[model samples]
Target chain A: MANKLVAHMRLPQPISNLLAARNIQTAKDALSIPEFDLMTLLGVDIEDVRDALARISKVASPPYQTALSLLEERLINDASSGRLPTFLKGLDAVLGGGIPFGVLTELVGPSGIGKTQFCLKLSLIAALPMSYGGLDGRVVYIDTESKFSSRRMIEMGRNSFPEIFYSEGMAQEMAGRIIVLHLTSLSEITESLQQMKLRFLQHEVKLLIIDSMAAFVSGDNERSGSMSRDHLLNCPFSFLKSIAEFSCIPIVVTNQVRGHNNDGTSQYSFLGKDTDNNSEKFMNQVPALGIQWAHAVTIRLIFEAHSGQKFIKVAKSPISPPLAFPFTVCSSGIALLSDDGIEMLGQEINVIRSQGFFSIFDAS
Target chain B: MEVSALPISPTNKEKLISAGYTNLASLVIVSPIRLSRELQISVQEASNIIKVTLQCSGAVGLDGRHVVLRGAQTAWEMFSDEQNLKHISTGSEDFDGILGGGIHCGEVTEVGGVPGIGKTQLGIQLGVNVQIPIVYGGLGSKAIYIDTEGSFMPERAYQIAEACIMDTLESFRFHRKGAEDCHERMQPNYFLANILYFRICSYTEQIAVINNLNKIVVEQKDVKIVIIDSISFHFRQDFEDMALRTRVLKELSQTLMKLAKKFTLAVVVMNQVTTKRTDGSFQLTLALGDTWSHSCTNRVILHWDGNDRRAYVEKSPSLPQASASFSVTGKGIRNAISHSKRVRMM
Candidate 1:
């Protein structure tokens, strides 16, 4: 007699619920190969293999239909919850106090435009208590360019908590809450962040910060597949969105603007390339998903350097129109300058621009 | 044949359950009006669906964005503990005292100044001093220094090290044997030579340096203090693209914040000043633009006034904003303004 062996796997709770709700004998029976095949054969409803995999991985429900519903509900809940991070105060206020959670907020600008600085400040501010314009949570920072400096953080912390600088313990206390990871590739970013979220489960991390998302995509390497690179860049933001939907964490990403034209001009295009060297040649904006990022993101912050100061403008916000703020860098760090300083910086920059004096534009 | 009733149009009950809304108490938290408006079908429809979801499905409730489960209290406690476990500070009257005790574990603080204004000096001092316990709140740890400008003087470090240790003039001298002894003692007892538990690196190698430094900060259980002397050096040199430099600086700022939080180490960054040419005249400014300004929690602008010294508190998270003058003498940083004020009163 031939030996008969059968493999059985218990269904997840959601799958069991889906099967039982549909009055199926078992989850296996409910999702029987014959039935799934029959549905495809009948052409009554289509089954997306990739989507099915996604459902099986994320949803607990047995029935694909129920899992789809759960996914939709989760997506909508994430969108409406307003957990996405907006890096700047102006950007957040315009975005109804914050960018929608479970999505992405991208700060884009040319070099020296304050994009990275804005990203760092957002990370620090996001971890702060709610009263001080923070969501009071933890943060996972992925640095592709290898630019994190603990000394800078301590110096920044000293401004707020002076004693923290003089005391190692206080520095540690402040430092421990920040989870920083450096990755050579964009792929490592998403995986590291997922693991970090699990490790610090209880800390309601309000933000996922990727300082200069462009670093993962662009560099000296002969990396091709622009779409894939963009998707990879967007991966961590998507993960943060999922966390934000369930745990309410916002994801903030900074992007470095690329100069499309080789012409010796100091002007920049934030999203895309320009066909001509003329300012009117500004074609479109480039981001993780062409215009998709602008649409999917609840807020867009554009940082521009005027004279010696950085001007933050709300390039795009879901709830508010664009506004501008002038910021200055001193020995201690960045500061919202007095109106006089802002005007002065603005005027000084105007003079430079009118003179058409171009500084050597080198991309880092 | 009926396609599972097409999921019942996601009725009021189904909506509540899917939204993680279960009981009336939890429903109220997300805004009763919004819930009521959403469930406008009928009271019976809402109640029946809720009953079906709760009794049959055993789904938890939703209070706005939060999923209301039974173990929420415990989860919240765990979250609070992770968020609030802060390190205390040493009672250093000038620096530590200004910070309400010590450096916090999860924040970014900036120490900014022009090149000669002693940005790295303060950082080096902290690197030597931050060697206590958590209760006393020191990692009893050494430091990892990233020297962008190549100006890190081992002699100066040795001098400070001597003060923190034996406080003898002989020990502070930069002799070959004294330097060797200081270097050996600086390493944790368990660490080996190649392991170089403490060292300094340059600016161009900052990315590689930070990557390695992060590992050291993490693996060492009781290690404390990570310092970057002049974070702006490479950024300043790679200044052709202000935008790219901003990105690098931001990346630096974000990574620093994360390491500080992950390791609970006191991270200190020294910043250099840049000369901005305006109207063909040059005015000194901090490099990296608003990126540095916005990212830092505290900003210390240091300058020289004739023979006196000045260090102004430009920004702080939990401390009052004030300019205080202090002198760095053989004994370390001492408050000059306070003494002068008292002298004037006398």
Candidate 2:
């Protein structure tokens, strides 16, 4: 195998001989031991140790891809057209037919306004037969909140696909196609995703749905370190992005929203910025995990609620407009509202702005 | 207890035992830096070995993250288990009532406020209150206090410990009337000594300390609470990259969340507030940006409301959006008035 690490290192003869004596065959083994220790244990010179360590840190990054090549690859890939549709007409229209494949889409909202219901309907759609407009592939749904209800999945199946749910055996087959994994801690979720890279190829999963991302991050546990967040978050989520892009699978993740005020003093972020996701007057609910998290996704949808009315906003998307769509959570699954228009939404925003709620930051 | 039980590579395993660490318990107290020196390996590699061994005594469950196909649980079992998880009191009745008990275990709770508005005081009080004997309606477990701003005063802790001990004794007296008994480890010195304090000087140290806390907890075995006096202190300065700060803070919070659940500890993080420029004025918002607001399971904002200190439960899954008045008295955290009712906001 050419002793991959040694071949890549370009180490001098004495240092390579020293590494051999110490049984340091791989680059990982060399990197795993401190440099000072390398000098004492291997009896190698400081200059050679520095050269080896520097080479390890500076030389080993993934090969860079050009924008043109990526664009060309996507253009010719037939699987790029595999966008599965949600049966709701209004949502399908706003989403430009359906949710696209190979993109990271977020469902952001407050607690319990049918974020899970949206995911359920999507899972059901993704698992449907190709004749019924689905991708005709399996789904991997990672549920961290332990709120994955098989009963609700069956209900959504019966509600959206009448013909498919005709028999108990059919339901069983559909259930088997959708593999639900219950994970609680953040470490567990990230580790499972790492292992799923292998299971993904075997299962031929077309859709990867993490019921909620913010839940596990804040809702679960792990260790700390000198390593920056850039290094930490980049591994799992960007790893996920690569997985989705490589296999042409659409990845869906749900996020929780936190209500905050618009104090322009804070640094502004252009990532996933929707000009009017929430006006300054409506308690200003933004997506959790901040602007840094916004950069990791390709699309962001906000499931908002106000004065008894429900709204699903296309807060961020590469191909969709910055607009809101009214929707309802039915017993079967999530459905769109009967009458939804840009004019009605504009009026609602105007009314919310006119009635000034007491901003309490002044209490300080 | 043997080094043979660690889920590490055989070569590393041989090096570990050769360095005089024959058992798992011996590795618990050995810092990663020392282990690296002793084993002639990198600190990262040393921590890896220690983490593998400390997670479990037997190799049967060494990969404790359990990403593998472990058995699943029903909602009923989760609910029953949650019901039995006890909370560490905030030392105030109204504060405890509005909090659904006190600080919840197996979750991260962030308390934010301007400087000197009792964030440190509340942090110290929780550190003391966690040591209240389990028989006296407390968790009775030790606390790990990571002080970033050097504001954690030992004198304040001693006073709080005194109050906690007195309260335990008083409860013991009341329960003795009911023909019940209490744990004898209720002395003031015992409570003070039980708190493990770490003073962090730099942002990297803060992260490194927290990253290494899992090893410390494995040795201690009874840490019920981990308090970061101010999680945002080091990240707020000299960092030109705003996006980098967000990712770092998010990752750190995720680590704290994982630690809390794995060990069933209440993680309380104190934060300082930054002023946000509003229309022709400035408003005080929690520091580290809006994204930092969602880093905790519950967000409590402490502020000065007409000279009365108030703690607002801004965000919680099970509690209402309410604020209650509490005081940092000479003893510890206590009710501001005889009847400081929960002020429900809409």
Candidate 3:
């Protein structure tokens, strides 16, 4: 193997003559020789030895796949695959039946607005069999925040599928099918995504979810202080896009929101001072990963919290309008809001406010 | 014992022993460049000596005993052993008492506050305090100060060192005779020499310094304190992509924590503050938000209470929620005056 690897390296004649004289027939043998020994034996400069090692390594590694091959592979796979239903009626309607396969769907929202809950619900939904309104496949839920909870999944599963949950060992078996990887860094996430390509080929994984992509990448642009941040970000996004497209797996990524201002008015104006204007000013809440990241996603869903209720707005979708609706997260998971539920929510807010339940608000 | 016991040639062994490679442990830690230069040997021979010394030191054991996985019993024993734990003092008695002695080694302590509130002062004070000789109530160790915000003042450090030297000399005068003869050892230059300062202008430099810190600490064996004055300075601005920033910050903190644990050093990181609007009002919070709040083992917040500088222990494992009043004077951080004195002056 070492000899074959060295045969691929086209070194200068002088270097080859030195190698032949020293009986170094292989790259491995040459590398195993100390730098000082190599220099002394070859009667060459240290730079020449370094160059030889570099050339050996370059030949040893295989070349990357071409773009034409990637495109051919994508075409060979089914490109017009169907969407995976999110199991929320209003959300499914806004997302045109559900999140589409062979594309990247970004879920952006602020903290405590059920972005994670929605992803968790999707993970369970993807794991369900087709007979019970699911894609009937496994899920790769890459949790960056260490917030992936199997206990919560069990609670949601018990609510969604009582018959399967109450059955002996069924719920545990179903939950086992969904793979959760807790990655703490961007590089680790990139490596895991690369490795998951092989895992996806072996397993029946239909969905790939990175719960809160912003949790890892946030605040790095200033630290790097170079233009390479966009390049560094492009690798994972492009890899995810290619993997989703080639394998026809739906990729759901969650992102955090930062405060944005348009025309001198705060977009997330929950202050109630501009009640009439605030409802129409939903475009100012920018996603965390800048415009470059925004352009990478096929669809962008923005989740917001307003008046003790959660709202999912289609911020930027290729097929849908700027539509939104209220939803509530219960022990059963995210459910669409009803007319009576909205009235009850209003009364609950009034009751809490009148009773001074949030005394910190008053003190502040 | 014979020098021939080493793997080198007889002539080379004599040279190595003459160059102070008499012991295996010392040979294991010495750099190859120093060995080669001192002994006038080839770099290859020096590297071979280092390799042999490392193997003999049980660092890379052939029997795999060096990599044994200990059970919870060993962990519990290590946790309960008080002598094994060491702390670097913050130089102020009140601050040290608030910290339950001082900042313990093998833990990351974050000091956060609004601008001009003495976070850097405390960092410099700790850098100076780390050099206090073990006989004078200190760890007698060096410090690696990685300054991101350029707040590390050498003049201030010299003043603190001078005050510390004076304090040590006064104690020696009371405890022993011929204290004046020890003036050279008590010089501020000696204290300043123990601090390795690295001024990082960008986050990339910060990461590079941190990634190579283990190597630096190993080369400088006495480095027991790592200070990054204002870890959040470069991170708070120009970060259009929050996700990338968070990832970098998380990775950097993890590396710092690993260095702290593996090298048994006190990692002190300084952070800035942002006014977070909660409940229709502004409240001062750490710059990196909730994601980074849990990264540090201990968090101390410096704030102003009238004319005095007050420190609050926002988070700690062994210490309770506590507050102490300390002021950063020209001579460095010191305990504030008593309330009785203030009342009398008023």
Candidate 4:
């Protein structure tokens, strides 16, 4: 049985011989020998000893199962798990509760598309206490372009939860919980992600937000041609994915988009005839970092601007169908427009057209 | 005793010493495969030995100050060396004058223009001109022509080479007694033979060619000029993300710059123009945008001025903002004779 278990562990031949020589016949026997003793006596490195120990533990514990089995187990244990509410009623409903944990969620769009505004709103929502539909955990905001604003967060907080913001110290306390890291280069971002395992544990970071992942990865230095840019990009993304899975945190990353060319036809139009055409055109907006990057995300939300109004569409999602909703970004932050509000705005615009007068509009 | 100081067995130490890895530096530079085969050790052990040797020699250090200081002096010496500062002639005297001497060594020179504006013609001329013997006021070095847009015409290169050889032979006849004696050896085929042409279709292949350029340069020791005819072909069309494209382009430029400095080679990169909307008016700009503007040490814009092809010195450290009217004839790029000069000569 000892030999069988030893064979099952699949350790390096040298390490196995050393273990056997030391009369570590079983997994338990190997475990009993201190890590220091294994390193010094066997003349093996710390990494090898750790690997051998891990393999031995795997053999000693319950049998290894497929990812499907583990995922199913997790599903049963926490049926309402993984979903973090975005706090917007219509947006939350479309998202099937909120952004799911253990996966990378990408929010991509062109400039002035409310992508950053949505992210800011999510960051504030993630920092709120459990009673207020938040994760009651810290937020990690990795800003690559230095566009993150604290004043906007304050205003959004004041608008969404006036009571919480009105309580003088509460706003500061909430703001303090969201840890913002301004990383400018791809290498710096990679280094930070590598060291974030410790930071995530220490700060109880539950939400990870990279304001714009495309900015740093696409810098001029990467053009040096020494290393593959695709691989350089894949490193941090894979690291972020692993971190999200291991920490059970929802990693929200934003990406920039370029005008998509379909069969040499201009697909993007500011004002279109039909809603379906607009959404289809918005869907075709090629997300940055290429197709490999597009596949890395579990959910992809695209923000589009049309004729002075903004819309958020579920471009790609695992749990939800593709949905589009009109949203307005104001001093209060990103708020979803109700179906009735859309019609009301249309009527108001018609009235203005009939009156032939330009009146100042209030978004609130 | 020195070999024994390393954490290796006595047998391995004896084997390593027998393999002539007598010192730390020798061990650090030796290939791991050779070390493993000679010492009858694992590849991992050979790698570890090299790592240890490098660590002990302080060649591979964490702080990098030691390496930088050591390299700075060597670089300074190389920089000061007159032989290392030689420039390859661009075949046109006026063009060479605008470029200080010609396409300069140890620097990246970018030629920007629209299609059919004689950019490729100049590139072909430079490729043929770089092969001119050092005795004939040339670098006497080979050229590496990386064609990204399939614009590299060997027939045109032959024409340019024939013209260059004729010019050189004529000049030699005026200067020397027996110039026609060695005319057979200085044929256009010889010039074409010296130019190593690499047709790169994609960005990946272009990068591969740039990365492996050092090996090619070392093997072909006479190669001193590297030309990439249009660097923006694959980059502009295939790239959806501006940042990724910028990074890749930046990396390519850096690699080219390193190659230029290392080999003291003149790197001439051809760039296409794009119409950019600035201040509510469309103006012609370099294809890769403002990010790549600083990548080149010098940028020369070639455009059309009616029937004559004009070259503009858009940006250069040494050269002033200037324009030279040049025409592309059946022979090659030549200074366009002004209307006044033509009348005076007549």
Looking at candidate 3, what is the lDDT of residue A134? 81
Please give the range of 10 consecutive residues that has the lowest summed lDDT in model 3 chain B.
B337-346
Q: Which residue pairs show backbone clashes in model 2?
A: A220-B257, A220-B258, A221-B257, A221-B258, A221-B259, A222-B258, A222-B259, A224-B211, A225-B207, A229-B248
Residues A1-364, candidate 4, lDDT per residue (tens digit)? 1223564567899888887787677654554345566689788899998678656654443222222233345557542255788877776775657897767888877776678888888888888998888877788899988899999888989998898989979999999998899988878877887777886655388789998988855544322321255445756765676677667788899988654433212111111223334334434454555444654566777776544555676655533433556677778888778631221111011010101011214332
List, residue by residue over B120-183, the lDDT tens digit for candidate 1: 5576566565653222223445455555433343434545555554432244455444344344
Give stretches of model 3 more than 4 Å off: A1-364, B1-75, B177-183, B339-346
Error of 2 at A152 (Å): 2.5
lDDT (0 to 1) per candidate = 0.48, 0.68, 0.68, 0.68
The reply for model 4, stretches above 4 Å from the true place, is: A1-364, B1-68, B73-84, B177-184, B340-346
Q: Report how far residue A16 has shifted in candidate 2, in Å.
A: 5.3
Which numbered prediction scores highest in DockQ against the true structure?
2
Score candidate 4 by DockQ.
Answer: 0.01
DockQ scores for all predicted structures: 0.01, 0.01, 0.01, 0.01
Which digits, one per residue and each the tens of the lDDT, describe model 2 over residues A1-364? 1124654566777777778888887654554344566779887678878676555433332222222233344457658645768787766766656777766788877777778898888888888778888777799999988888889889888877888887658777777789899987667877887777776666478898987877744432221211243234534565566677656678899887654445442221211223333455455555554444554566677776664556776654433333556677777788777524342211122111111112222332
- Chain B alone, TM-score of each model? 0.65, 0.75, 0.75, 0.75
Model 1 spans > 4 angstroms off: A1-364, B1-92, B133-138, B166-204, B275-284, B337-346
- Residue-level lDDT tens digits of model 3 in A1-364: 2343454479877887777777887654654444556789888999998677556644432222221233244346533336788777766765557888777888887776678888888988888888988877889999988888889889999998898788999898789878999888888988887877876766489899998788766664452322354445655776676687557788999987654433222111122334324323433354566544654566777676544446666655444434456677889888878421121210011111111223424555
RMSD of 2: 27.2
Query: Model 3, range B271-304, lDDT digits (tens) per residue?
Result: 8765455565334567787889889999988865
Error (Å) of candidate 2 at residue A77 is 2.9
User: Candidate 2's residue-wise lDDT over B176-295, tens digit each?
Assistant: 552244344666667767777775545655655665677678888999999998887666643457876676677678878989989989999988765554455345577788898888
lDDT at residue A41 of model 3 (Cα atoms): 81
